[model samples]
Target: MVTLRLKGLHRVKAKGRIYWYAWRGGPRLTGAPGSPEFLASYNEAVANRQSSDSGRFRSLIALYRASADYKKLAESTRRNWGPWLDRIAGHFGELRIAQFDRSDKIRPVIRRWRAAYAETPRSADYGMQVLSRVLSYAVDPLGKISSNPCEGIKQVYSSSRSEIVWTDSDIAHLKKTCSAEIAQAVDLAAHTGLRVGDLIRLSWSHVGEDAMIITTGKSRHQREAIIPLYQGLRDILGRIPKRSPVILTSSKKRPWTVNGLASSFSDAKKIAWPKGDDLHFHDLRGTAATKFYVSGLTEREIAEIMAWEEEHVARIIRRYVGRQAAIKERIQKLNEARKS
Candidate 1:
């Protein structure tokens, strides 16, 4: 048995093996002693659990944590929710859920978030949205909270992007300079209009002979995606040797984790755009939308390819590429009039 000196922490031996456990009966530690899990679990077990039944806030959060809905969420989603929910639990955890009214408590908390994360105001907005959802759930047929305090909370954050489309020259330079891995990622994003998350998670099975099917990530709805497998995407996939279940692997031949992929792309981007253009991996989706428009696809057809709403597609094409086309046609007509 390996013994480590730590408060409220000990190792138990059974069948010639030692296991770490919290001294008092708490959740079993999952990692090696003195690891991240050990320290977190130790602190959790030994921390003060002084809250009583006086407030339904913590209790309601606990109930929601154990609900089927929270449990069934995708791994990436639940991971994103952890820190946000933990913050909410820490902020008003001891207050009664029914008393979360906009007149005082809720607005104050929202303002605090807005002020604290002024640089990333979107994060603060997201926190309010999360709180609102919990409040809505509490006000549902199952719970005692009568109203959602987060209703009509103004979204002060503007998510407008000045992302420029990657020209053919830009894409060619990126493919030549970038590693074979990320180059392929860029190509798939441009041709198929898939997000980085979806690209990294894509499998050989998802790519049929003529079309690739996908379940989109990071959307309110898990949209069914079906984009045709064009020659560009076909050539990219054909050359890559399959080492993992995921189609795109890292230089180490392992499947790319989301953060890992981002880091790699960041490095590749510096090489590709040395002058620091305002392009990102996601900007390829807009590039794809433009390319579809130039190829004579209607907004409705482009919407189907990208799995986006028709109105959004129409607006984007009109604002960016389609308007330019219309202006050029007007100029051509004016030239003909002058000739007459």
Candidate 2:
């Protein structure tokens, strides 16, 4: 039952889309301010209350409502999803709420966006996914549209296909060459398989007597990773002062950004080994998942430990478990030879 009333569309000089002052007093436009075509389109949509159908408009209204219930998301989830929401807003900020439908007109827009970001499939996939969700929510339950245009969109953009699993040497080098904070970050990634975004911001409060209870941003699963207080992690955690809220932090004792940590990890990797960029922090999670998978842990168990959905685990296996079967077969042959 979301309603949007159009105000006047004004032309902006730079990269401006249509700007409509809503009945609720918020401005809407398709693109960022200052794009020429954006300004013209904003004015056109506002002037005539264009009855044209668009999925973008419906999606925006749903997003607005969803944002109102922000508390439902974890702090990290909010931080990550915010950018996607902004990008969607930038593309369809000014459309009439009621005019949203699956139209051929928007296909080219999606196609263009997909093409522009062909190299980075993950970003493109995320954009499409957010758009799809928005549109799905906008569709009337009474069969207004036969189907969502976003259906069957390829996930080539947001996939783990490009991800690389870390080797033992990579782990050893990172531990040896990185700073204390960075080393701790690497250890946590290795042991817990948490993302840099989640690991760097983790606090003593999230740790309990037996395990580290982490909430993932990529999904809603609440995972409690049990890293049996081994000497290394225990020693590292023992060194932290009682006053700090996080495990890895700056001299000022603040959380680190994912990019910042990734940069540091990269620098440390370069100094520690010949191939610094061979692996990413995310690969640690993949490695851990592989370890569990090899140990005959069910996909559900791996997902529980990693805080990923079941399908995500399957996807990871398909993408990265290349040598697992070969290694298992080699072991089997060795065992048969020994028995003979």
Candidate 3:
């Protein structure tokens, strides 16, 4: 029979095999070495192979090592999945991959995450999505698991409460209250529905004499977005230095972080706009869409210009198209008067 020993530790031996029992007294295995029965058999085979000088133990070690899934995931995907993977690793504490029942293993984690983020359900939902993506890679690419544990988990509910649209008076108040530069950024965002990311990344090269082409950052699917240089927006762009690529950068010429922009915007609003009329930077996008709808642009046309789904046109039309028909009638009357 094979003798088993550890440095200041104990081991079990049976049927000419030896094994170092797990120190924590949990299971007879450590770190995904296959099933408990498989581990036992592997130990016996190792002892036999050592006595016979066979390659059986070496081949089994290679096969078990090959079963690890983390190697197959892409670098970018691994970076994105890192936090979730670390959490899972921390909770399990070196458990065997084969020992886990996908649902039973992850459901409790999800439950705890949900409870923690009860007030902000979106955070919980995002956590689940991150976990699901990692599990998908583990099951599909790594082949460590036959099925993804993330499958069929009910997606956490989130609210989509619509934000109030900024009014003309609000815009005027903001312009009057903010510094010339901050007011320009506010005005440009109001005129174009470009995201804050796209807004900050904009370079002088993107802005020609007649129009501005924003390299969109949201989906990065649209390639580039085209916005006409209206007279007011052109005047703002003119005020910015010709050499600076970013239109709204700080003195260091670096792009604004979301928090940085939000803080600047908050300070600007507090000084310029009246109380109780405060709005977010995103509200400018809504205001821009509202203006476009009221300016005789069709819903389909607005969707194209704004990169919004066509389904949103109805709600936008309802919100902004009020009183526009009267304005159109007045314009028609003015044209008839000129003709007469």
Candidate of highest lDDT: 1
Number of the top candidate by TM-score? 1
Error of 1 at 75 (Å): 1.5
- What residue runs in model 3 are displaced by over 4 Å at the alpha carbon? 1-81, 88-113, 132-158, 219-222, 230-232, 235-245, 249-260, 272-278, 293-340
Cα misplacement distance, residue 203 of candidate 2 (Å): 3.8
Per-residue lDDT over 137-185 for candidate 1, one digit per residue giving the tens place of the 0 to 100 score: 7778455666776776677686555336777898888787899888777
Model 3 alpha-carbon miss at residue 61, Å: 23
* CA-lDDT, candidates in order: 0.71, 0.61, 0.59
Evaluate residue 141 in candidate 1 and report its C-alpha lDDT on the 0 to 100 scale: 47
Ranking by lDDT: 1, 2, 3
* Residue 146, model 2: Cα distance from true site in angstroms: 3.3
Better of 1 and 2 by lDDT: 1
TM-score each candidate. Answer: 0.64, 0.61, 0.51
Write down the TM-score for model 3.
0.51
- Writing each residue's lDDT as its tens digit, candidate 2 over 234-265 gives 77677766546777775456677777777776
TM-score of 1: 0.64
In model 2, the runs with Cα more than 4 Å from the true position are 1-113, 116-122, 138-143, 155-163, 204-206, 215-245, 249-263, 273-276, 310-313, 316-340
- CA lDDT for candidate 2: 0.61
Q: What is the lDDT of candidate 3?
A: 0.59
Residue range 1-340, candidate 3, lDDT tens digits: 3343422222445445654433311123332234556456446544533453212222222232234444354333434444554344344423455533457876675577556766777766766776565456556655666776667777567333234566778778777767655766677788887787777677778787777876566544454566778786787777776546567775455666666777888888777754545467886787787677656577787766666667987776554443554376558779889999
